[model samples]
Target chain A: MIRTKDIFKSFDEKEVLKGITTEFYKGKTNLIIGRSGAGKTVLLKLLVGLLQPTSGEVWYDDTNFFSLNKKEVRAIRMQVGMLFQASALFDSMTVEENIRFPLDMFTNMTYKEKRKQVDSCLERVSLSGVNDSFPSEISGGMQKRVGIARAIVLNPRYLFCDEPNSGLDPKTSIVIDELILDITKEKNITTVINTHDMNSVMEIGENIILLYQGEIAWRGHRGEVLESDNEILQDFIFASPFLQRLRESALGK
Target chain B: MFLKNILYHFGRYVMMLGTAISRPEKVSMYYKETMRQMNDIGIGSLFIVGLIAIFIGAVTAVQFSYQLDGTLVPVYYIGYVVRDMTIIELAPTFTCLVLAGKVGSNIASEIGGMRQKEHIDAMEIMGVNTAAYLIMPKVIAALVVIPMLVAVGAFISIIGGYLASVPTGVMADADYIKGLRSFFDPFNVTMMFIKAVVFAFILTTVSCYQGYHVRGGSIELGQASTNAVVFSDILILVADYLLAVILTS
Candidate 1:
């Protein structure tokens, strides 16, 4: 589990996250949902040590993340994997080489062993037989899957996904969400995702925290999201008239 | 304000080099990267370096031959002047300046693109020392290959001098060969290698620094590439003057 204590992050005089304290439980898909400028990205970066909090403590299962030295922080980071919004894969390397990168760097595994591990990861992501293709040669959805394959190749204890469904179609988005959810359950890892997709919020949001102007406005599971009395959540999530009308009909109003 | 900005960038550059020189996570990975970089820096750049070097020698020989016309100085001095000038100043300085324009901007753009694409961030999150992995190979490759290029340039430059003067009938072939053998100083060759090594270090590090710290979008990336070449050229010139003074003194 990952926990933040009074995490306050500011840029110059502009405060982004104000005293955000929350827990992301292990083996659960913890989603941070918010509108634009709602500090979702900043909060996620803070949890992963990409950005330092203005003043707070981040505990990664009793290990104080901020208190550790550079080497110690790197040790912690070894067990952490992230899927960027753009799926930051190396352009010059093939999918197989990209997946094998971490293993080649960190492990003494032989070439045959690393190749087996890479193939297994590609198989797990249902991306078999495209190992020699570059990231540009594949579709965006395939690239994201390759990104996931690379991320989980190391079998991290913590998996962070930033906007995993940004440019993907709704059906593909659901597939990606299910993949992440399945991986989380399979590994029992602490998973934190920052997303704006309402479908993701309703479907895979096992533990959801709604951030409004940096502070936590509402906290609930998907089951409770529609019934909650939080005005900000309602306005933000049901922004479109079509969605609001669907919500009203569902609530039988 | 200007001084403060300079100091800030300088401090960051120094700190980055400090991080870059740290012990590698995997020596084999670094070795692989270094070999790839060597091929790119050395073999890939061969045509341009050789082209520029030949012209530099030919121009020096022709100009010096004209100046020595009807003068008390021996016609053979044209060859001597071309040989010494190419080794002492022209080859190392000119070849590196051209490379600062070509390779320096390329390094900056490659790295800056990676930064914009969040590739560096991904590597960092993977517990890889992004600085060491990205930078050490390029620097090491430059240090090894650039001096060899300068040596090749110097040798080609002398041949160029011979081609221009001997073929044009401006000076006798025997006089040119005699001039080439006259007053050879081993220390001057040492000075040339020193300049090549120093210039190589400056260009690669300065370019890497520009690319690594780049922020913002495409416009910022273009600016970083430009700055890489500009800063590298300026530093190379300054270092040239300093080395000239130090080595001769």
Candidate 2:
């Protein structure tokens, strides 16, 4: 579990996260949803210790991440996997090498063992025979799959995805969402995702926190989301014509 | 404000450098990084250095022959001039300029790209020493390879000067050999080696720093690459003059 207490982050004098506190639960898909520049990414980064909080504390389990030394922090980071918005695959490395990277750095596995592990990860992601292919050779969706494979290669306790479905078509986005959900459930990991996709929220959002500006505007389950009477959430959810029509039908108006 | 910012960053860079050195695992990573950088900068640069060495040697010989005509300057002194200039100045300074252009730009672009892609942050998260994993390798590689390149450049230039002199019929083979032998100075050679090492250190350090600290996005990375080469060239020229004045005087 990851918990933030009164987390405040600023660049120069412009506050990006404003004294926001939230808890990301274990064994479920915890979604932080907001429009662009709404501090969703900042919140994710802060949780992963990529950026330090200007004030307050980030706790990974029982230990305060901010209080740990560099060495201690790194140990915790090794157990946390992040899927970046861009996939962030090393362009120079082949698909197999990409998956094998974390293993190579962290594990003392032999060449054959690493290769076997890479193959297994590729199979899990439904990617095979593309081990030698560079990232540029693969499709965007395929690259995201590879990114997921790399992130999970170490079997991290916490999984964080930042706009994982960005730049993908709606269909591909659903596929990525399902994959994240399946992996989270299988591993029973604390999975936190930052996204603005409503379809993703409807599909796999077991727990949801909606951010407006730099504050959490609302928090609830997916079922509660469509039924919520909050004006801010209604404004956001009904902004989409499909959801607005659904709302009208459900309300009999 | 700009100066203060520069100073602040400079202090950060120094602290990072110190941190990289203090940790054993980081030092090991740094060693590996240095070897990789050496291979890229040193081994890959041989062709350009060779091409320049042969042409410069031939041209110097031709120029010396023209000037020596109808003068008391011994024709044999052409070889001595070429050997001294090639070893003590051209080999060290000119090769460094090429390195600054090629290797420096490459390092800057690579690190900038890594920063843009958030790989540096990834490394930090993984408990890897970013400087050791990134910067140390290049530094060590430059220190090792630059000196070797200087020696190769000096050797080629001497042979090239001899061939050029022979074809021009300005200096006899025996006289050229004698001049070369007489011009050899262990102290001057040591000075040249020292200069080469310093040049390598400055080039890699500045380029790496520029790339590692690149802000904004991919466009900023391109800007960092350009700035790295430009700043390194300026520093090399200044260092060259200072070293020359100090050594010769």
Candidate 3:
């Protein structure tokens, strides 16, 4: 579990996140949803200790994230896995090598053991038999799966995905969402995803926080979204006349 | 403002160097990375170094021969001048200047691209010290390999002088051979290696610094790469002067 206590972040003269306090429950998909400049990414970065909070505190379970020494922080980070928007797979490494990197760097496993672990990750992602393929040789959806495979290769206790479904078709986005949800449930991990994909918010958002102009404008589960009646949430999530009408019709109003 | 910017960058660069020299998380992983870098920086750079070395020697020999005409100096002094000049100056300075353009810019672009692509951040999130993993191997490889390349360049350049002068009959082969053996100072070779080692450090670290701290997008990346080459070349020339003074003194 991750908790932010009145977290605030700023860049120079501008503030991005203002006093965000929330808990991301373990074994659930907690999403931070916002418009382009609404500071979702900033919140995620602060949570992961990439950007320090200007004030307040971030706690990964019982440990204070910002107060730890370098070695201690690295120890915490070993249990943290992140999937970047661009996948961030090494261009020089094949899929197998990419998946094996964390093990190679941090484990005493032999080459055969490493290869077996890599193959297991590949199979978990339903991407078996592409071990030698470079990232450029794969499609965008496939790359996202590969990124997921690499992220979970170490079986992290906390998972952070930044816009995992971006640049994917709706069908592929659903696949990615289901994949994340499954992994979160199976691993019983704290999964925090920062995204603008409303489809994701509706599908896999077991818990969701909507940031508007650097503060939480709405907060609820996916089931509560359509009936919330929060003005900003309505304006942002159901902005389209078609969805607004569909919402009205579905509500039988 | 200018000096302030310079001091800021200088401090950051020095701090990065300190961070970059740390112990690796895994010794075998570092060993693998170092080997890859050795292959890339050493083996990948031979043809260009050899080609440039030959031309530099030919040009220096021809220019000195022309300048010596109708003078009191012997035509054979061309070989001695070319030999000493190549060893003491051109092989290290000119060769490193070329590498500052070729290898330095390449390192900067590679790292900068990784930064922009979020690869460095990914590694950092994995509990890896991105600076040490990415930059140390390159620095080690260049320090070891660049001096060896400079040595080869010096040897090849003397052969180039023999080719340029002996075939054209600017001096007798026997006289040129005598000049090569005459008053040869072993200290000059030491100076050459000293310059080579120093220049190698400047180019690798300066380039890595530019790349490691890059922000924004493609435009910033391009500027970082250009700055790496430009700063490395300028620093190399400055270090060459300082080394020349200290070593000779």
Candidate 4:
């Protein structure tokens, strides 16, 4: 499990995350959902050590993340994997090479062994073919799948996805979400996702935190989402009239 | 404010170099990258360096020949002057200035594009030393190949001088050969290599620094690429002067 304690992050007198304390459980899809400027990205970055907290403690299991030196932090980061919003694949490398990058950098595996590992990761992501294709040659959805394949290639203990569904169609988004869910369950990894997609929040939000104006407005699972009386959560989840009507009709109101 | 900005960048640049020189996570990966960079910065640059060098030598020979027409200096002195000038100053300084525009901007754009695309962050998240992986190979490749390029440019320039003057009846072939053999100072070649090495370091590091710290959209990326070339050129010129003073004295 990953835990944050009173995490406060500020940039030049402008505070982005105001005392965020939360637990991201193992083997569950923990979602941080909020509107733009709601500190979702900042909170995610702080969790990943991309940005430091102003004052707080991040516990990766029992170890204080901030207290570790650079080498020690890198040791922790080796067991961490991230899937970026834009699927940050190396443009120059083939899909196979991209997946094998972490292995090549960290392991003493032979060429054939690395290729086998990469093939397995590609298969796990349901991307069996197109190994030699460049990132630009594939569609955005395929790139995201490739990104997931690369992320899980190392079999990290902690997985972070930043806006995994952005720019993807709803159907493809569901596929990506299901893939992440399966990986989390299979590996028992701590999965944390930052997203604004309401579909994602409703579909696979095993544990959810709603950030509003740099604070957690509400916290619950998807089942509790419909019945929650939190005003901020209600306003965000049902912001669109279309969604509001859909939610009302589903409730038989 | 200006002083603060300079100090800030200077400090960051030093820190970046420090990080970049750390022990590699994977020696083979760095080796492969260094080889690729060597090809890119060396073989990719040969044609342009040769073309510019020939022109520089031809111009120097022709101008010196004209200047010598009404003077008491022998016609053979044109070859000697061209040889010394190309070896001591023109080849290293001029060649590096041109590469600061070519290879320097390319490095900046490549790294800056990676930054904008989140590739560096991805690597960092993977526990790879992004600074070392990205910057070190390029610096090493430049250090090794650029001096060789300067030497080749110096040779091509001497040939260029001979072709321009000897073929046009401006001077005899033997006189030019005599001039070429006139004064051979081994230290001047050492100075040329020294300048080449120093200039190469400045251009590569400055360009890498610009790209590594880039933090915005296409406009800012373009600005970073431009700043890479501009800063490298200015620093190369400054280093050239300093080296000439220190080495010659």
Off by over 4 Å in 4: none
Error of 2 at A99 (Å): 0.7
DockQ of each: 0.83, 0.51, 0.85, 0.87
Highest DockQ: give the candidate number: 4
Candidate 2, residues A1-253: lDDT per residue as tens digits? 9898998999998999988888889999999998789899999888888788899999889999999987788789889887888988889889998888777777878889999999988888889889999999999999999989888888899988999999999999999999999999999999999998888988899999988889989999888977788877788667878879998898788
Between candidates 2 and 4, the one scoring higher on DockQ is 4
| CAPRI grade of model 3 | high
How accurate locally is residue A233 in candidate 1, as Cα lDDT from 0 to 100?
93
Of the pair 1 and 3, which is ahead by DockQ?
3
How is the predicted docking of candidate 1 categorized under the CAPRI scheme?
high
Off by over 4 Å in 2: A251-253, B19-36, B245-249
Write candidate 3's Cα lDDT for A30-127 as tens digits.
99998899998889888888888999999999999999998898898899999989899998999898989999999999999999999998888889
Candidate 3 global CA lDDT score: 0.92
True contacts kept of 4: 0.78
Model 4 over residues A1-253: C-alpha lDDT tens digits?
9999999988998988889999999999999999999999999888889889999999999999999998999999999999999999999999999999999999999999999999899999888988999999999999999999999888899999999999999999999999999999999999999999998999999999999989998999999988777888988999989988988888888
lDDT at residue B165 of model 3 (Cα atoms): 90
Error of 2 at B149 (Å): 1.3
lDDT of 2 by residue, B179-202 (tens): 898857899899889889989988
- Candidate RMSDs in Å, in order, are 0.9, 2.2, 1.1, 0.9
lDDT of 2 at A17: 90
lDDT at residue A253 of model 2 (Cα atoms): 83
